[model samples]
Target: MTLEALERRRLGALIWREKRAEAPGKEPLLRAIAAFLRRHGLDMLEFPPALEALRARLQFVRRHEPDGGWPDWSESGILAGIEGILDGFLPERFSKNILKQIDFQAALKAQLTYDRRRRLDELAPEQLTLANGRSFRIDYSAENPVMAAKLQWFFGVRSHPALLHGQVPLTVQLLSPAGRPVQITTDLPGFWGGSYKLVRHELRGRYPKHDWPENP
Candidate 1:
């Protein structure tokens, strides 16, 4: 028998809460209803980590550079955000099995207007270029947000990289020729003037074949 719209929604929310709290494998009908609830505005699942990381980058910018336009990630804020993004975009009825087909990243991106998205990319880019023109991904999940690359590539670098419009400094993890982590610092000039000399002296003996420039 077909349930009324309200009845389906109530059952869907209950089942969804239960499924998240415990084991999976609910009936197809219930799952369908739960998926329907999600498509609507009743979804209560925790935000996915990937989406959260994206939001974290935006939040980092907002926190450090408070003058920009960024979304609030609080419970009410996100519900409103989802509602706004999913507007006129949901189908009337779809199977629960296709729930995973939703492009959540796209939905999150939709929350930001084109200009803001462009601003976001500029302020917190996924990858950054080094002195040697090599691009490396930035780890936003790190305590201070780090970029790791071989020390040799930073030969001409005199200043540490900054993010969030220069409000935050990126922690750099320099690696050896063999990709072994050699040093971690946020001050490139300090390392080059002070510790780099000692490090160069030590590593040169161990890695005789690799050129460790004295001026780097």
Candidate 2:
């Protein structure tokens, strides 16, 4: 749904809650949460998936571990947030499933990934030249407002953290002094691990429309 529609729905839900009306549905709460996150730079077009994730997450929160102390409830604000949606929607049957599925180890692994994703800051240069001889770079950091705009246009980008998570490729060469990538490296993100070269191969092999380099 459109951002504006989401905003309206979320606000409507909030007003209803303040007035002691029935709590809002999941969609509205998700939208409210998504909208609020956007204010802080979440950059997503929609957060429908976060609803399921949050549901699974909340169950984990209430669990009692072996230690006498239960888990800290620090993130209750975030949970409480976008939570009005769960007013009546947090299903009962889903409890067993959510508790079972929330493997802390698995969740920990996922959190690590999310942490790496969060660490991804925009490139300092946004564009660079490897050798400057038959080479150019789009660092995705510097004066790449145009590049950022293009991302928003083609990939629905809105936040400074677009290039992370391998979600969308920051298209360069076409927009930069270099119209083709001499060498593309995804190593820095580490999430891409060693797949940068393979990604290059795929670029050349798959979407020829973008004119990926075959030689390098």
Candidate 3:
């Protein structure tokens, strides 16, 4: 079934359960709802523990995040991000209570996941320029931070042996020639790092005709 249709059916089934518990044929209905929720991105384990309380907490995070602006993060954003990792992937061996008790900020920094879209501020940038004043910059902006480091060698072009290159988000920017006018940063993975990434992204994105360091 389509994703929307599936979620709707699951919601109805769960709501019905709220109205009546252990009713006739409730078991089959619960099973079906569980399967649907899982297919639609809910974790199998988290699905049961969530109940109405957890759903509200999770939904609060979704609704509270104001798109196009900084998230209402001074309080719960870090908590929510870290919680998702535990709720979505941690095995049963790690009790949910452990997740609840952990310091949100410290726990949030466990590692970056390449499988997810990274926060814009958490991004890193690499730029490459040619002798002719052309430039290219790339950013590996995935939410998964750990994967970015592991995949660093993925975008290197064999020919640009000494070229300056780096990641900003999902994009990879590279420069050519040994003495290009490109710039990189030592402030990577922090506030200064974000500024560095943005600078290159804007410079390259605005001037796309340059022979950006390419694989060939």
Candidate 4:
């Protein structure tokens, strides 16, 4: 039977009670139920970092563009509507071992209409293209969105990129060859002209193979 039909009839609790009555003890039944819930991605354990970051980006867009049709991805909002989100997405008679393989993002995306889903991509892009045509992932988990990329990738880029239609400026984290943050700044032009000289001088000797141009 469909999950909706089951909920409408309140059969879940009834079935649990019947199972408990037939079972020797509560532990086995409880464990079975927990396993079932976990397998279905309904256990409400902490979401992975990427999923949480997506949610945070959605929230950022919602705050900046109140009139936009973005839906709330907050904990309360999700909990209230997760049943509807999962209604038709669940497979029938799935094995517990495959629980971890479920794509929660796909399920969440399914909940949004086509237009709002497209808007989500436009407002909170997963990656931004650099001057050298390299795309780096944006870290939306920060107070302000930040993009960390190797310094060489942004060689000709003079201005810092903005999000939410230029309302929010993105912080850039220039990384060394070792993937360490050599510099962090919102003003890319000033950084390029000023401290970049000293940075280039220091890092040139350290990472000789990597490009540390004088005019970067």
What is the per-residue lDDT of model 1 for residues 1-216, given as tens digits with 9 covering 90 to 100?
122222222464464332222222234334444444545643434467777778767776777666665777544556544545554344445433334544556766777888987888899988888666778888877557888988888899887888977778999999988899999999999999989998898789889998988887
Q: Per-candidate TM vs. native? A: 0.70, 0.18, 0.18, 0.69
- Kindly list the per-residue Cα lDDT of model 4 for residues 1-216, writing each as its tens digit: 111102123465554332213322234433443344545554344577777887888888988887776777876676556555555544444433333444667777776787876777887889887666778899988778889987888898887787876668898999988889999998889998899999999899898888777886
Q: Write the per-residue lDDT of candidate 3 for residues 143-179, one digit (tens) a residue.
A: 2111112112323322221211233222222222333
- Candidate models: Cα lDDT each: 0.70, 0.33, 0.32, 0.71
lDDT (Cα, tens digit) per residue for candidate 2, span 117-191: 333222222232232222223332222211321111122212223232334444332211223443332222332
- In candidate 1, clashing pairs total 0
> Candidate 2: what lDDT?
0.33
Off by over 4 Å in 1: 1-53, 73-81
Q: Decide which is better by TM-score, 3 or 4.
A: 4
Q: Give the range of the ten consecutive residues with the poorest summed lDDT in model 4.
A: 1-10
Considering every candidate listed, which one attains the maximal lDDT?
4
What's the lDDT for residue 60 in model 1?
A: 66
